[model samples]
Target chain A: MARKLLLEHAQVPGINTYEVYRKHGGYRSVEKALKTMSPDEVVDEVKKSGLRGRGGAGFPTGMKWSFLAKPEGVPRYLVCNADESEPGTFKDRYLMEKIPHLLVEGMITSSYALGANTSYIYIRGEYSWILFILEKAIAEAYANGWLGKNIQGSGYDLDLYVNIGGGAYICGEETALIESLEGKRGNPRIKPPFPAVKGLWQCPTVVNNVETIAAVVPIVNDGGEEYAKIGIGKSTGTKLISASGNINKPGVYEIEMNISVEEFIYSDEWCGGIKNGKKLKACVPGGSSVPILPHFLVCKTANGDTRMMTYESLADGGFATGSMLGSGGFIVYDEDQCIVRNTWNFARFYAHESCGQCSPCREGTGWMEKVLHRLEHGGGKMSDIDLLVDVAKKIEGNTICPLGDAAAWPVSAAIRHFREEFEWHVNDPKAAMERNYGLVNEKVNA
Target chain B: MPKVTIDGQTIEVAEGTTILNAARQIGGELVPPAMCYYSTLKGSGGKCRTCLVRVTKGSEKDPRPMPKLVASCQTMVMDGMEVASKSDPSVVDARAAVTEFLLINHPLDCPICDQAGECHLQDLAFEHGKSNTRYEFERRTFEKIDIGPYIKLHMTRCIMCFRCVFTAQQLCPERVHGIIHRGDHAEISTFIEKSIDSEFSGNVIDVCPVGALTDRTFRFKSRVWFLNPMDAHRDCPTCSGKAVVWMYGGEIYRVTARKDKYGEVHDFICNTCRFHTKEKGSWTIEGPRDLDRHSVISQNHYEHGEKTVR
Candidate 1:
């Protein structure tokens, strides 16, 4: 069994409260950070810990913090990205609902390190219950003097507030979230004046994921080198993976990054294998946006090396046979599930959620959805298979935001790996309408 | 000043000049077609994605190439940056794809539309788009609405360029309409169907790149190709009154702001001069407006002195 850094006391009675969390050694990182370490020292420790963001992008958090432009007399900010609206990813909600103080503590320590006098936690609007839990924990922290002006007489002033989004998936993007925070429509701003330089009302800001900010507590509580020693090379420290779909025990699990993918799937401590003794067909190891890997490549790399639950191991084959460990939303598909229907469903989500700012994502996503819908139903042509690929390629790299790529990758990967399934639909639309292609090993040579 | 290269043509521009503006400096075929970017309107570009150019080398300091094609309207040029616009086959292909995306939902009703001859989208499609569309789905449509007494809102042809919204905000004291909803369902709408009554609201018709917003007084009056656009102006208390009056034989059809080659108006005309004062006696006509020989509006226009208008 691996050590649990985040969820060790998740099952403890009243761990959501400030008293029980403090008894379990919470806020010690805040004290250690504010009283003993300078802001630059704290930043140095985070940089040494090799901690990448647990967000989908997996950028190094330390480098992201260092990029916050510090012009004198101007206020800097640390924004917690609690807008966990990605499909198949609910680990942030689970962490906040289970232990809210950890995130509040992280916000304090991270705000101190960034020299931000004020901070905000932009949470998803759908998590209203979790918002209640977090607010309760934040009130408790303020009552206990862990938050607010000059915490523990350390001469550092901080104030943290929580703001909820209006239930849009694009708000999870940093600039869109900042726009929503400023009481405007959630259209993503064009880049080059990144949020690190000018964000949140033209102030320098750093937006970190919920888990990435929470991990700063552990990096400060223990030394950076000690935390770095827990996981594989470069994928240091533990991660919270929100496991769902076709699994026996579907829940969030904390795994040190050294574990193998097969062990995590079949071991009783984790997902406990596929449901109902069914054979595994495919899996989207990351969230819905990442490429879907076939069953053969799920447990081992294309070179036959055992794939581990790390950033480098999962992305070893670079979209040919490999996938990313994106947001750790491990989704498993059994033999009975249809890949074409799933791809269409995701396309519909992207089309519906597109902010309509850019042309490609605005029109191309809906066009792909209509084509995929036609292919899934009985109204598809033989030429529609290549047409889908062409449309997805056109939209991939030509948009103002990454939403275009996210909408394009699933369709491209679905046809790349599961071309046979789509061809089966096109070859015999009547049969596809009646039944699904179940667990075929080889192509039908249509 | 920053020096940049577009399609192997090198030019030095003022510091903070965008790549699209830089391409315009070396004019002719090098300037990429821009539908949403109007230099006069603030925060108008980057949504259309028609002017995307590849940066082969990022800059002198960071010589690494940008991984993806960037919207040239929003990105500023770093010194020694090399951009590939028409020179790269990928940019041409990308512009075609973007043209298709813009046309898929757009109702291509150029024959009956008032802005047909002067429409930017019509020219963009003729140059960069495929002859036939591959989209089999039903094109989206909306009802014609009268946004004001002077302007008609044809929602079906709007590409969501947001130029009109910027025009209202920057020129009008109170903007009554804006883009509402989101995604493909997004539309420029007034709250609770309120009519736009601003004094300067007629300018929205000029800023529209398509026939989405047409002049209500000039609706279905005549095709722009048949009218001769002459440079004309009048002195008014509210606005500059500098405008181009579209004239037929002894009749003034419509009056609009004098637009530059890029279809941008430097001085905005008020509603009184645009709609109410369309008469030959009210203004001094300053010859025929110079039209680009390549434009559809200049098809039968005698550039010498409107000799054919008997």
Candidate 2:
């Protein structure tokens, strides 16, 4: 298979090394961008390529770049929002760890394009090993004159720094990320002056996800129109999805944007179908934040359209059936697994990460957590099931950021698709408890 | 500027102004529920379904909007857009449903809630919500997790507004408060197990739309309907965020946040006001010249004719 942008050198073993990366055509984009393409040309090329952010939002990357405040030469910043705290989304870690130079090269090129002399990679703190790898890789780039001033004597100056996050999901929000970078707590700023306008240090900034920036390297090398032709319709590009949970081969797979859900799941080239030959019960097509699709509905959607990976196709019918390609965190559920319990896990994650800024998200998350915990562990009543659905609906689209909606989607989706699971827990507490604890033990053993 | 008609009143507002704000800009006959929006903070948190309004006229494609009751907090103002807040059936139904749903798990501890007087829950309940819940189940409960010294928990009374979380972002520089879980099972929790240790942790108590979150020091001291908030400021070494300490029986019982004064000029309080800002009535009435700071003047110097410690 002719691997496109993401998988071009993805199969190359030990590409983490600078020499191996160089051999596989890395750092060429930075050299090309600085020595040849003007910053404006780079932006125009990206605009033409129609490259959207891979960080869940699917915002147009070039449009986001165009939003920058260019007041005739004020310092702009290029911040790589590597705070990949989104649950089930682990594509960036593989890319950054496998080819650290790829990110650095991407950052250098993107920074130059955004008119930024300084850049910072904000990595989530859990990746200590990745942190060390990046630090060393950055040192290598510095030594090779690729990161520091006058790289390859092109007279393009750029500096990069890595900021360690205190482990916050809110920091992933651009403005909140800027606040954390400014040495404050990771809380989202009220937007009006989005980061592109008055970001990091009150200067114009462009915050791109790790995968988003890395994608830029390829966009520049291959012509924009050529890159655009790979994917179907508006979903123009390959996506690296973190396919975990109940799958035979639970791994990150980079598939064309138009690949079907069935192909992505059952194809040996991707998830390799359900584990232990289990029946598919349901699937959270995107990240935990997107709505969960029931096996019946998902199959219907998949059967009706064998090509449904793009933003438009995946969300073709909105919440009624479709799910979002948020951060490409694809989690599948087998028939035996309880949807309520699975949703509770996601609820627990969001409640933990909520920055406690707003009441609905803060208070509602807690309320939902307690209710879900009760329902899952066996103390819940029938009305509790209704209450859970009600609370989930209340929390959805109600808070400051998508966090509220993120919290709401899984609960609402779980109840909508599998209220029977929660009813089983509430109606037959002992059996549900037995099932839940069994899964917990199974998880531990696995 | 866009010419928008809110209710029956025709008005003009700056472009990009949300429909809710536009209605608020020009006094409208239709009462739109703008519960989650705080115009002070640039367009946010349309979580509360209260600000929902029906765009009954103008614009053919959206003559009948999908949501039917769109959150006016999110929908920006458009030219010739007509909003039906009071008369709209869908808006009323959505609001009533939202309020009832919000109040289902919320405890009946409002009599003792510090936010009872100024709470959106209380106002919305009487105005838009059903008087009683059909839910015949045990309300969702948390064991009143003590997040920090500054903030208290009463999980039974929460309504899940993002105001506290948003307030933490703006008023407090640090991340002391945030949501912990997802969906109906989500909870507002501190980072890891650490306390909500922030300079502006008290604002969380104030911004908590409901009593789910409360001030620990003032718990059970005074109900919101009773204690008159005496306007005051703290001369604490760190923050000057106006500390409107609550007083009862001529004695200050709680040193809570004064929301009116939180702005660019002042209201940036730190740990000093949060922890050490005690009631002035608690003072011993003695100078620190002769003895220690807490030393009180003796009755010998307290005579009507006698001079006090100077």
Candidate 3:
């Protein structure tokens, strides 16, 4: 069994309640961090853990925490990014819904480490029921004296609030989330004055993913070195993979980083293989933003190395034959799936979610969607496929946010790996509209 | 001052000067077309990707070439930096692609449009647009709305440059208008259909680069090419009182805020100077030489004397 850190106690009956969570060794990290360690010490421990952010970017959590500018008389903030709206990713929602107290405990420890007197959980508005669950857990924490004035009599005061967003997918971006929290439109702010220097009412702030902050609990419980020893290479510590799509047992699973991709896919303990014994056609190992990998590439790298479920291994061949472990949104596709239709669906999502700030993303995403829609529905010319690639290439790096690149990658990768399929569609529009490309029944390495 | 090289021209600018402003200072054809950046607005760049430039060498501190093309309006120039705009084939292709994107859904009703002669989109499309677009899908359309008593909004023509939203937020005290919805359907909307009846609402009409926001008062007044702009001013307590009067056959058609060589309004003129001070008797009209070089009447109708309108 993969070493589970976050979901070890996920099956505990009353884990959502503070009393039950406390009985099962909750808030121990808070006590250890507040009483025994200084803020710098806590930060140093996180740095030593080698824990990269679980958010799509994979920035170093400790380095990001250290970058918070502590100016005189300015209140710093620790904002928990609970706006998990990335397509095919629902681990944060599952964690908050099942074990709400874990997040609360993690926030407390992280806020103390960052010297934050006030904190916020900027959750997506669609998660109203999860908001209630989080709020109830927060109330329970307050009642138990884990939050509020002088927590654990350590002379540190912290106040955590749950702010509901107007439900924008762009709000998942830290700057956009801060803008939304500030009662403004969720347009991404320009960087160079990153959130560390000026954010959330122009105060020094640290915006962290919910999983990144929650991992602080384990880093504090065990030493950073101990936590670092579990995962392979730079991707240390257990990660929550939100498995979906054609997988049989589709849900969130916490796996240590050392597991091989083949075992994780075929083993009964994890995704339990493809649904209805269908062969795996492709896999988006990370979230939808990362490139999709064909069945052969997903199991092994281009150099014939067995692909491990770690950041370094997954991104071995860059965007050519490898994909990133982005937010660990593992989506599997059976042979019956249509890559063109799936690409169109993602393009539509990006076009619908763009804040219309930058032209490349705002305009390019819509163009990709229109062209893909034409191709999928049988009105496409052969030149339209090249145009889709052209438009996607134009949008890749020209936008103000990563959303532009996210909208570009899937289309580019699909064209890279499956150009023949797209050509088939354009060559015979009538038959393409009537039926999908169907399953590729070739043997595994054929 | 930091010295930067742009298209073989080396110039020293202030430490935080952007490449767009630097190129604009060099003037003539070197000026990159910027659709979203208004010199008067504090935060009005980076939205429109029309100002992309390739930096061959990053700066003195980081000599590596930047990984990607940057928005010239947003990126500040550093010492020993090498930048390329119109001269670079990649930048030209990028600008052309952006121009295509801008015109994808635009209702090309230029004949009846009030801003045809002065429209930035029209000028850019002429400069960088392809003869035909590959996009054969349905264009996005929105119903024309009278957002305010003075401004008419045709949302379909809006490229989402966000200049109007920034103008309303910065100039209007009661900012009731903003972008609503998401993605391709995203549009500028007032809160709950409320009228954008702010004191500075008419300025949005001037700041808008497209015909999305047109002056309702001057909707069918006259083509901008036929109207002569005369420098005019008034001694009003509300604004700087300096403006330009658009005249046709000795009748004052409309009054708009005066702009410097850079096309930024010299002062945020009030509703009176913008809408009410339209009479020729309200202010002194300067000679025709004071009109901007880009103004349609400046290059087209130079034969017409000031007395021709008087």
Candidate 4:
């Protein structure tokens, strides 16, 4: 079995409670980090861990931490992004719901490293029940001398609070989260004054994802080098993947990053192959935003190498044949699935979720959704296929936020990999209306 | 001051000046169209992608072409910066795409609309948009909302530029209206149907780039082309005491905030100056000067030589 860092003790009885979590060596990283290591040393250890963010962007977590500006007398903040609104991504929710103290322990260690006295967990509003679980765990941490001021005679003071977002997917963006935290609408702010420089009430802030902050516990406890030794190459340490869609086991699974994609999908230990023993058609390896790969490309790279679930391996072909390990949202599509309908569904989600700040995202997302809806329902033209590509290209890099690109990638990838399926929908309107274009036995376009 | 070259023309701009402002300062058809950016309003721009320009070379401080097209309104000009606005085909294509997005859901009721002649979206579409549209699907529509006594919101015309929302938040001491809902359905709405009854509520009508938010008093009163705008001022205790009165025939039709040559409102006039102080006895009316070159009204009327309205 893969070494499960987060969900190792998830199935233990009463693990959600503070007592059980503490009994199972939960906050040991906090003790090690606060008592033994200085803030700089903790940061250096995290840098050595090679831990990239588990969020969709996959930014280097330690590098993001070192960029936090420590102006004299200014209260720097450490915001944990628990707003797991990305489609097919529920790993953060699973971690928090099953083992809330892991996040609490990680937040304390990360806050101590960044010299942040005040920390907040910005959770999505739909996860309201999870908030109570986290709050109870935080209270337990306070009672156990982990969160309060001058803990263990360390002369370090830290306070952690939970802020519930009004359920905006854009709030997952750090600046937008900061805006929402400050009691404003969730519109993403412009860059250059990044959150590392000026954020959250004009103070320097470091916003890390729930999984990124949670990984710090293991990094500090086992030593960064030890954690780095587990996974292959730059993808060090175990990652929690929320596996769903056409899978027998549709739940969060913790796996070492060195596993091959085929092994993770077919082996009994992981996804256990497609549901009902059906043939694989396409798979969105990361999240919905990443490019959808046909079954052949999902198992192997465009370079004919066996594809691994690591960041470098998954993104080897760079949006042409390969997809990202974004938020570890591993969604599998069986032969029965329709690419046009699925792409239209994703477009609709984006059009509904867009903050309407940028014209490309606000206007273009709606246009793509309408176009895709027309194509899916037999009301499409031959020119509309290229028009979808054109619209997606226009929206890709034009908006202020990544939501534009996220809304574009799925449609472009669908058309790139499965243009024939779209043509099938357009050419035979009566047949297309009756049934989906099932899996083709032919090789991928690449 | 940092020297930047835009469209083969080089000019030095003050520190912290945006590329859009610099291009406007350089003049001669290089100025990028900005739909959401207001020089007077803070925290505008970046929402509208109409001002996107390719930065070929970064400043002396940072020598790297920006990875993608950046919003020129938000990007500060740096030393040795090279920007391609109207001269670049790619930039022009991007602006055209933005225009298409802006017009995809627009009601396009130019005939009956009060802002028909003086709309920025209309002018941008004429310059940047394709002759025909590719969007064959149903265009989005919204119910007309009377947000307040003075404002009538035809949300179908809103392109979600957020200019009015920012204007309301910044100018009104008590802000009640803001953008609500999400994506294409997102519209500027008053909280709990509360009337946008602020002292400077009518400034939203002025900041609106389209006819989404129109002054109820001036709705369908007269086309903007027929009205001759005259510089007018009043000694009101509430505001800056400056405005432009749009007069048709012998009576004043509407009064709006006076914009400078760069199309920036000199002051965000209150409702009293914008709506209540339109009477002929309120201020000293000066002879109608030629329309400021940067104003949207001027761009619409530029084809016709300056006609003396008096």
Candidate 5:
């Protein structure tokens, strides 16, 4: 029974409708923000809330908002990144589908804070049903005077539109999403002129995640200080964790960031304690891109402290013995699943989704995917393991976008924590082909 | 002017000069290699990681180093910035990795390719690449596609540098072809197979870093090592008409834009000058192109001493 902000009304029936959402105190932030507070006051309150972007990067949202350049006579934009294409991350989709008005309300308030005349929600193309839901919600808001020209007589004008993406994972990246919105190919632009300075047809722009913008509603309604008191430290406020993979209750759960990782995975209210009483082998605490943690380090840190679900606690060991709370894609792995095969699957996704702008990502992603495929399919050599690490290292810091690092991390982490598993595949090809390498008993090379 | 130190050599450049340009101003071995960055073409660079350099110190105001290696071709030179190109072992390793990535799927058909003697990729492979490749997967291949009567699009040889796309948008009036699909499957395609018939369309062949785009008229004509390149120009209404005429036995084999020491074409020649007007008597010769003594074209031809080639 933790505090739920974004998803408090998620389970309410008819929450998708404007009237139903209005009766339940929806869009209160819009009224409070536009009526009482000035635009800069809203930004100040958000900064006080200590809210961070729920996207994989975990950058501070208020800090990101402050970086938006305010050049006179030049229009600034606030784009909602509804393109939730990351694997095992479906909380945004769930939030939008269950309570679409929450996002629309967030868009209106966030846009007012940023002084944007027009805003956009660039949603994933695969979520066509949710797109329809969001579009309907936006239309409902415009009809009720919550959106568009002189909202509730505040004299602050705003118009919000929903744009659908072409179902590519790279479009989730801010610059690539901007490129796709501009009716062009989804190649990521090189940064120096970041999106905050020159974005969206050469104007200042701020792209916030769906959950990040929606959370702004609560930050506005409850006041930043009230919201800041919920979660622990800098990880203030409740976060939506999209739990999946070998969990009995594998659904999106809203938890305050103060809970321990053991409580989250084993509690009856949360994941319902890994499916069928099976032994948990590992976990990718964040999304697929973050490092994977073995069973020994999942519930506790390498320093033998209780691992909380906060950002600092999850990343306590910094990729060697710790992982990130990235996008909150808490995926659990049972003993039966093989790390090598899973790593290869993620590699294939990255290779397929890469925009092919730069050389390392364009070629190296596919190269790693092919090498991992050979290893998984019983045609690997022991030397292939080190070669994969070398290639992944080369691609980590050398691309036009983070997609290169995203593609490289899973491969490197798999081999880093589970080298014996990879070597097992290389050493015993026939046995590896027949069945997966079951759970390692004693952490052979960890 | 900004004073930026690259590889321990400090130089002052103009207000908005890039790190790559600053290094080029102090030209020598430290000037990073560029495959996609054509100086004259707007919005061309940063797509090729070949020119990546480490900024050890960001600027005089912000002394913090950049978190990652940045593309030097696009990064502006901040005052008191310290950059490491060939001087750092890490930069060298990154360049070698980039070179390897660029060559994994490249059809190593330099023996038959027409851009061999002066290819930027050839020089890069010689300098930064390993002797043998580690890629065991089947190399990507594509059928030769002729974009028009003059330019052949050899998609397999492309490194996705985007130089030709920038060239088409900037130099040519209408751009018909661009990169289609994504990732490793991406190719330079005309989509519905439309012929690029613009007057300045032939310049795409020159801006291409590899043999991806070549003069269709000169396909398989001869290896470039045998033909001596001579600087020549003609007075024409459409363009500057300054070009290099590749000649063998007193006959023009192929015509191309005259590239600078960095292999960038500043004066873009038109199709009429490049494809249609190829004769020994069409223009005044400006002597054998001052071949870099280190260039592969100058290997055997300069043995008779640079004076006999013309």
Candidate 6:
């Protein structure tokens, strides 16, 4: 894939400082867009560029800006969704840790374009050090003419603040993020009046993922049409995936959309192949929340179509057969891994994480966890497999937000693709437990 | 108003009402079965799935629905929507499976539980669950982790739904519940290493979908059914909501968490409030007080006969 021109200066020394950033052509996009181009033209440019959200939803960036309800006499705000709590996804952490100025430049440009005078980055509470770096960077940007007042004489002002979350996975949901920003618990509000309508403080708001905002500086500098020419249609632009779990090179990688699932697995550029060259067993292509895809199905859809690593392609067969690009948390499992145990572990997470407000999710997540754990621990009977499926089905589409569905995907998918593994556990519980249960749990606890 | 048919009975309801909430509109109950539902819990679980009711007509997806049942907790009542919840055989089957699934992890600790007689699981099982389960598997167990100073851990009894977490966090974000495990063995744990020491911690005991999360203060205190519930202010004085304080022999035995018009509009003392009975009503009243004393200042002149219960 062609390394887009903007991300080249990302990892260099002094790149975090405002001076070095300026020397390497930083904030020029803000100058160009603010001084020369109309905000509408910028929105149109991003739309034409086919830049989708890099924050895992894969929504079009410009299109999302366009969706902002243009409420008059109200202070429109920009919220950089930096609550990167998805397990195994840490690409945003690396970017903020290494290149704070890049994100600052992007925030300035994106904020100016959206007519947002004030912006808040709702960062995860665990990233306090990252928050400190951002504060220092913000102070530095102010010291230079890059931030406050007329930036490079463009007659625009932007102020940024870091709002830390109180530790919630649901805050990744935009409204929840807004609620957390307002210093409240991060329960997602009902939609229809989306964040763009009545968001943070009941004002117009634009909540973009951190990478989604970081990608904006490039969109402004390179121009939308130029950026559009780079990636495939629909799944436009490059995505930063945090690939981890039983892989040769377990880290972050920036890959363009439309890469084949086969190549991403085999190529050293992403996961560097499964650990010890073990045959692949199953994969949760989009964080722990997306559906689990077996090796065979991960390579191709149920209709024998090869699956590509893109928003549209991966989700081609719908949720039953397809998985979402949520949070780009690619988790791969080796052939020796037990699907039942893995599914059980995920149930435990959902059950534990469930806010317990909604009954189906609260009770169902626990029920699913218990059943899955029971099945995995060799106490499962044949009827237990069906019971697991039934529990997952109950929680699939019920509850306040998509978190319920997220919790159900792995269980339902595991049962759908590997019901035999569950049955095997029922047939011989002790063997299954001794075979797949990892002793590393001791390591994890210790 | 849109006319809808529920279990062969037609009724008109306002637009955009949920079938569960709509069934509530038809007055009296319709033999409803639910393992994971509590209107006070904010959003419905739709998890225990005991609330499954077949939709025979009025929905496009399942026009010729047979054994197909949608969770009434989730599916909204629509115009001309036809539902069969009263006598749907599939509903019974689904509820049975839900009961069985819930039992897979239910500890034998219920005999010692304060929620025993009032537990929804016990009730749902009586209504639709099988007496004998073939699940001879070892129950998934987690060493006790305190959710709050007031609430005790028996994680083995926890279902991992986040009603307690939401209450904890929504009241005070940093001091709430968290999911510790992944997949089947996952559990809701506290983020900090400290004991679940939040003021809202006691709410977990009442909001818990199962026995996993229990109140240290109330657990093993008394059988829930035997206690009388009375409605009054969340006596925590700092909190809002019509408190549901259960009393036996003029002593507060237990308190079922409640969210009234006040608490829902603004989530506060429902957090750090200490609910207690300020005064007693006439002795003619039965078990448990589920009243809002603030609103009963004029109801049947009951306040005039108030006794010093506290």
Best by DockQ: 5
Candidate 6 interface RMSD, angstroms, 1 decimal? 5.8
Q: What is the TM-score of chain A alone in each candidate?
A: 0.97, 0.95, 0.97, 0.97, 0.97, 0.94
lDDT of 6 by residue, A30-77 (tens): 878888898888788788888888766777788899988877799999
Worst 10 residues of 2 chain B by lDDT: B288-297
lDDT of 3 by residue, B1-310 (tens): 8889899998899989999999988887767888899989889988888999999999988999988898899899999999998899999999998998888888888999998888888778877888888778789999899876888999988988888888888988877888888777888998877888777788888888889999888998899878877887889888788778888989988878876665567488888888877777888877552655454434454377654421
Query: Which residue segments of model 4 deviate by more than 4 Å?
Result: A436-446, B294-310
Task: Name the runs in model 6 displaced over 4 angstroms.
Answer: A268-277, A374-378, A428-446, B1-310
Tens-digit per-residue lDDT, A18-63, candidate 4: 8898899988998998889999999999999999998888888889
Best by lDDT: 5
Give the CAPRI rating of model 3: medium
Models, CA RMSD each: 3.7, 10.5, 4.1, 3.7, 3.6, 9.2
Better of 2 and 6 by lDDT: 2
True-structure lDDT of candidate 1 = 0.90
Which candidate, 3 or 4, would have the higher TM-score against the true structure? 4
**Per-candidate fnat, comma-separated:** 0.79, 0.08, 0.80, 0.89, 0.92, 0.11
Please state the error at residue A82 of candidate 4 in Å: 0.8
Q: Which ten residues in a row have the lowest lDDT in candidate 5 chain A?
A: A437-446
Give TM-scores for every candidate, taking all chains together and pairing residue i with residue i: 0.97, 0.74, 0.95, 0.95, 0.97, 0.70
What TM-score does model 4 score on chain A?
0.97
Tell me how many clashing residue pairs each candidate has: 0, 44, 0, 0, 0, 58
